[model samples]
Target: MTGFFTVCTMEEEGADPVIAAFYRAALEPGQWHAALRAFARLAGGDVACCFLKAEAGLAPSRAHICGLDEQAWEDGYRRYYHAIDPGYTVLKQGMPGRMYLMQDYISARAVARSEYFQDFYLRAGVRYSCSGTIRDGGGLTILSAHRAAGQGRYDGRTRLQLQRVLEHLPNVFRLRDTAQQAQVHGALAWAALDELPRAILLVDACLQLVFMNQAAQRLLCGPPLAPSLASATAAIVLRGGKVGVRATAVQQRLAQRVRQVCAG
Candidate 1:
């Protein structure tokens, strides 16, 4: 499991918490906001975001933002300003795992003069940015940390910390993909089982019922199996949360069989 991760020793004490947040966000995409918050805190930025960069002339998608007005940012920046932003262009062309400061692509004077900066960045209160690309296969998966106009640009130490975090992003993406596939396969398997005509009951090692199909439910609700059984209504009874046979001898036999199967 650990083999999938990049080998990097993060000297900062915050590394573990940041990594944990990223992994949690990977497993559950809704947690991305929290992950971004952690990223922002670790990188010493006011805001952080993750977004996918598509082909030229196209707006980014799957944006997870923190410490900003989400709707306004998406509407103004992604929909309009992204196409004209030089920093974004540089990010699109930047190498994966390599951090790029806004200053590297466009000078502060140039940014202040550009329409993209005046109309969007100034209005958004974000002037300085440090960003990096993690995955750039079909589309670029970019992570960016933003600072307000007065706040200083991300320093060398912050850049190094972001780099360390960037090294683990691929593993997060892989884990998310694996989890999605597993969920898809699980749904399909359950659907197939539900459609089966035969009664099916899934039980644990102690014959405790884990799951039952529609056929199993129907069968369990039907008439009693034999008059000789203790219970006249049904052959199977859910007693103490375990699948139980009404007849004593049959219950013992079922338990024995289940035990053998579990052992094997």
Candidate 2:
């Protein structure tokens, strides 16, 4: 399990609560906001983000950010600054396991003049930063933490603390990837079942509908009733009281199938 992450700048008063939050987040990558927020709090920074490298012209395969709105990140930074981000270029060449403070690769004076910094980071209020890269086969994971202007640079102690926390990030990411793959596989299986021509319906123990395919949705219910297989069948038999023989037979078969599925 990933351990607690602590920073030199934040008050010790809130350390216990922050550490607990980090543990929960590390175990569940779906809680990206929690993870990034915890890291930002630890580093005394305004924002933090994680990036997964991607192929040319594509945005990072995955981007998790804290303290920044989705619109600014996706529309502004991802659309423009990503094309010529000096920090990203530096991350591409960074050695695995080593953390690089912004000052090491780009001087403050140069950052002030660079288009990426001037047009994006400056407006975003990011000044001091530290980043690290972890290479996994052909993939790269980058962690970028930043402080707003006037917050001063990360000192030696902060750097050491960040390095310690970075060491466990790869393991946490591995768990997240595995879970995501499982979800994708499940979705694919359901999609294949949905493509069948028969109006299939899966109902629960209470005879309430759980799932219905596109075919089932189109066949059963009309505008007046619930547009679903079970509801349509019920309305036809109980309310209309004049369903066709073939239609009634099909409904009976569907009911039997639902019973068999629920039994198993």
Candidate 3:
């Protein structure tokens, strides 16, 4: 389990209650605002920023920010900081175990105080920023935390705490998705089959492993399975009077059956 994350062991006079309150709020859904503000106050900076890598040419559309409004977000996109933003482009190269801090940007202070970033920060009330990558073999997820004026810039200790949050964010999401998927699967018997121990694989007509369970996840991705590593999502099984191509065979069989009935 992750440790309790705080900037320092010793707290300023009368600061504990305030920080503890934010700590409690962070646990509640839709209460990130308290935590974000707490981080800024703790860091002695002003802003808290968050980032998620997005599809190309859709920076404005997909950027995730905490303090700013749509106009600054749109302005950042229209102005092309999405491209110039070192955190976005640089952090993509980072692996989970590794992390980075922007200690020496030629335009670091300048850009932070620039007409552009400042407007976004001032309007949004953010003073500091921290970003980290969260990815499993399943896919990629990145989160950036932000702050505004007097919300101090991140220090080494703060960075480590933020990194801990980065790692946990994915698991947090998995739990959320599992809950949501459970609600959906409960309504459909076919999908509810996923709860079973059997290795059930759902493939499109194309024979891809669109979904699989722990049993299948282990088998198909293990040494025993003969799926091609090059395939996007795949598994091996017998179907249609033959072995290995269950998805493809299932599609072909269904098509043949459909054709026969149509002819009749």
Model 1 lDDT vs. the true structure?
A: 0.72
TM for every model, in the order presented, reads: 0.64, 0.59, 0.47
User: Over the stretch 161-233, how does candidate 3's per-residue lDDT look in tens digits?
Assistant: 5555455455344443454566666543334334433344444433333455454556555565344532422
- Which of candidates 1 and 3 is the stronger one according to lDDT? 1
Per-residue alpha-carbon lDDT of candidate 2 for residues 143-197, written as tens digits (9 for 90 to 100): 7789887887888777766776676566455544544565767674345335544
* Candidate 1: pairs in clash: none
Better of 1 and 2 by lDDT: 1
Instruction: Order the candidates by lDDT, highest first.
Output: 1, 2, 3
Q: Could you tell me the lDDT of residue 247 within candidate 3?
A: 67
> How much is 41 displaced in model 2, in angstroms?
1.5
Which whole-number lDDT from 0 to 100 does residue 72 have in model 2?
A: 92
- How does candidate 3 fare on TM-score? 0.47
Ranking by TM-score: 1, 2, 3
Candidate achieving the largest lDDT: 1
lDDT by residue (174-204, candidate 1, tens digit) is 7566667768676644454454444556677
